[model samples]
Target: MDAIALLELCNYQIVFPQAQTCCGQPPYNSGEASPAKDVAWHTIQVFSDKKLPVIVPSASCAAMIKHHYPTLFDTGSTEHKQAIELSSRTYELIEFLEPILPYNKQSDSSHTHISLHRSCSALREMEVAEPWLSILRKLDGVEVSLPTLEQECCGFGGTFAIKSPEISAAMTADKCEHLLSPNPQSILSGDCGCLLNISGHIKHSGDKRPCTHIARFIAQRFGIQHD
Candidate 1:
């Protein structure tokens, strides 16, 4: 919702087809190819208009569609072609907005310090480096810092956490420890999965620092609120 609001605020038309569903990352990451393909095909068909760009707020989802979708279908098949075509137009929100959002020039004495947690997919699959930082820097009085082991996964590999609870918990513990090391006012990430894992662990540990997606952070900076 924040993502849509941010885009609309930037004067971009949002064609939200209610029929659109998940990017199929869960099943795909779990090694379930059949159901994953089903979801991918549904998504591709829903966003079939080749003229429009698909902007995903979540880097993990964007990586699934942009980097993994084509591999789901047989090479040279129609689905493969469509997947590749869709991948070409798909982009993560911050990455898409990095080159376009106008800088905030107004002088506001208020300050915001945030620790950024870049998801594994954002760092590795999307190959994006500090796009969120670049965007956040444009906002007046905003400062962004990276957690220790910024390149490491936050232990929420979708189904991985569900399958290996113990290992997941340990990784989450380590991740949260590093994220808190910077002691930023809030923890921000591009992927909700990371935010969920990090925030849940932190809250469980009695830490009150807010954890949220970058879209929401940016939207709030722009005075857009949603419940």
Candidate 2:
């Protein structure tokens, strides 16, 4: 909902390709190349338009399409060619919005302090670090802070969390401790996986700080309420 509101604010004619499925990142990250390629082919076929920019909300998914899709096929193959073409047109939501944040309206006068969590994929793979943080700073009353281990992995490396639940849980606990030290009103991240990992830990430990996606945070600043 916030994604829709934010894109609408940007004056983009948003279209959902109902046929679109996964970008095949999960299997690819899990080291299953054959099944990953099959899923990639289906995704490529679904998003067949050569001219449209694929704006992905998740940094991991965007990175998969932009960086790994072409590697799944042989060089100079038709699939590889199409993957390269799609890669060139793909952009993460924050990446797509950085140059065109049009919401200039003032939010409530009350100040908002938020702790930001940038996933390893966003920081390392997608190369998306300050876009969303900078966007929040541009708003009327948002104050953003980074954890001491901001660059550390939240352990939700897609399948990594599933395969190594104990290690993943420890990382999440460590991440949550730092994220809550400042006692911010909310925690924001562009990647849902990180948000989920951190928020779930916080909840189990009886903490209640709101964890939200950056798009939703930005949308609220522009008076766009969730439905």
Candidate 3:
């Protein structure tokens, strides 16, 4: 919902394929290529209409489709060709908006300080750190602070965190500490998994800072209310 609102704010037409499902990253990352390919092929068919660009709210999902999908099939194969075509059209939400949304000259007095939590996949795979920072910098009166260890994982590597609770907890602790050190009012991220891990730890630790999705943050900034 927030993504749709954000795109509307940018004056772009949005399309949602009702049949679209997972991007197959979970199975792909877990060494289950067979099922992963099945999911990927389904996704490919859902978005086969090449006229519209594929905009994904989650950077991790976008990365899986754009980077990992091609590896699921042999080169020159039909599925491989479809994967490459899909990858070419896939883009993270922020990446899609960067070229469209201009800087708002009006300053937002409500939020003076905020921190950004770049997902590991976004930073490493999508190479979207600078693009996201550039977008945030354009917002008037909003100071964007990146944690010293911004590139570190937030301990939510999908099922990895579930399987290794102790390690995940330790890493989440480190990430939360860095995020709160700046005393920002809120933390914003592109990935839901990172936000869940970081926000869950903050709540458990009794911290007051709120963690929000980047799309929701953008919508709030634009005065577009969404549930």
Candidate 4:
């Protein structure tokens, strides 16, 4: 709902379906495979017939529904077939917008600075950095930077962090440490769960930094502007 609202505010036509899960990652990553399967199967059904590409604001979910589904279901199951179809159609929101958003040729020369935090899963799984960076650079009012990290996991491994708060907090601390370099962050853009984790850590650490969903930021920056 927020995504669609922001997309409309930024003038990007949002063609989202009514029914979708919470990405099913929370339970699926846990040993709760049965419920996960039910959720995944539901997703496969909802998205299987989409001829238009599946655009997701969340990278981890897209990666899971795309990359992890086939392994979770039997080969002959309807879920397996649908998973294969959806996987082929799924795309990260940033990856989708970076290519599709109209660039401001004159604006590319303008000035602004921000950092990109390649979320671990999105980095390893979807490789959503370069395209997003390219799109940000194309904005006349913006500059983009690639941030360094100690490791991919920001300790919020879905349920893993829940089962052990200490480990998750440690990971979040390390993540914030790596990300809080002395740089001007107009925004720190990331894929999905990582964004939430990092954003939480930033606030928890008493820092007043801003973060954005890459899609929302890009749409705000360079989607069709209306009067």
Candidate 5:
């Protein structure tokens, strides 16, 4: 919802197809190729218009579709061709906006300090660290802090946390510790899974800081609220 609002703020025509579903990252990561392909095909069909770009709020989902979709089919197949076409037009939200949005920093006196949690897929797979930081830096009076270990995962590899609870908990604790060291007012991330994991840990630890999605953070900056 925040994503749509942000795009609309930038004067872009937004379409929300009811037929759209998951990007099949969970199953695909779990090595369930058959069901993953089925889900991916459904997603490809829903966003079939090649001219329109698909902007995904979640870097993990964007990476799955942009990088992994074509691997699901044999080369030279019709499905493979379609996957390639779709991949060409797919982009993560910040990546799509950074190049197009005009950033004339406003002289708002309000100061906000926050930490940014770049999901594994965003940093490693999508290679969007610079783009995300560039967008955040353009905001007036916003201080973006990097955790001590910025590149480490938040221990939210979908099923990996469920399969290895102890290891996940340890990693999450370490991430939370670093995130709280700066004592920021809030934490922001591009992926829901990372936000969920980090926020859950923060809540469990009784931390007062809020964990928010990047779209919602930017939307709030524009005085836009999502229900």
Candidate 6:
């Protein structure tokens, strides 16, 4: 939902789906598979109204809502049938945005230097970063740079980091290692969980805080256009 707010402003219609929910991550991850299945069934009921594509920012959640729910449902039930419909239209936010908002980076943007971070689950291995880069490249003098170990997890896997503080801290340290580069004028990421955790690590570990999020970054760059 972090990015959804801005997506609306970016010309994407927001579909406030019914029964759409937690993707059952908490219960499913907590060994409550039965409850997770219940959640999935409910999700199917909620979203059956419209066929608009479901755009989720988190890869983990998107994949679950798309791929996991059907298996959890009673296969012969009508609900299971509906689950199939939902999955086909589901997309990670970047996946949906990139193809829809194609723009020439060289002509539309102005910035020259930017460093991008890759989300852990979105490990389409930086493929997702393209949309963000495309957007930033349109800025009035922005340059896209590379983050160190951009593939590393920022250690905020929902509640995983909170539950395992030591391991989470170690992983955050790993994410910080690559992102601590001194030269990039700014840094950006698609995930807020990553931002909060990474920023915390940067502060605690003594790394310069890189700017974050393409929307806010663009909002600043397009101040006149917005006004």
How does each model score on lDDT?
0.87, 0.85, 0.86, 0.70, 0.87, 0.68
Tell me the tens digit of each residue's lDDT in model 1 across 53-72.
99998899999999899999
TM-score of each: 0.95, 0.96, 0.95, 0.84, 0.95, 0.77
Query: What is the C-alpha lDDT profile of model 3 across 1-227, one tens digit per residue?
Result: 88887777777777788998888888888999999999999999999998888998888998999999999999999999999999999999888887687456223446568889989988999988777888778776679999998878999999899889999999999999998889999998988888989999999998877899887877767777434
Which wins on TM-score, candidate 3 or candidate 4? 3
Reference-based TM-score, model 1: 0.95
Tens digits of per-residue lDDT for model 6, 8-44 = 5457667676545677877776778899888887777
RMSD of 3: 1.6
Per model, state how many residue pairs clash.
Answer: 0, 0, 0, 2, 0, 16
Q: Write the per-residue lDDT of candidate 5 for residues 1-227, one digit (tens) a residue.
A: 88887787677888889888889988998999999999989999999987899999999999999999999999999999999999999999988887765445233437899898888998899999888888888887789998888889889899999989999999999998998888899999888899999999999888878999887887777665444
Give the 10-residue window scoring lowest on summed lDDT in candidate 4: 101-110
- Candidate 6 deviant stretches above 4 angstroms: 1-11, 18-20, 102-112, 124-140, 205-211, 224-227
Flag regions of model 1 displaced more than 4 Å: 105-109, 225-227
Evaluated at residue 109, the lDDT of candidate 5 is 30
* TM-score quality measure for candidate 4: 0.84
RMSD of 4: 3.2
lDDT of each residue in 1-227, candidate 2, tens digit only: 78877787777787788888888888898899999999889888888898788899999899999999999999999999998988999999987887798755545546989999988888999998878777777777778889997888987888889999999888888888888888899999999888888888888888777999998878777777534
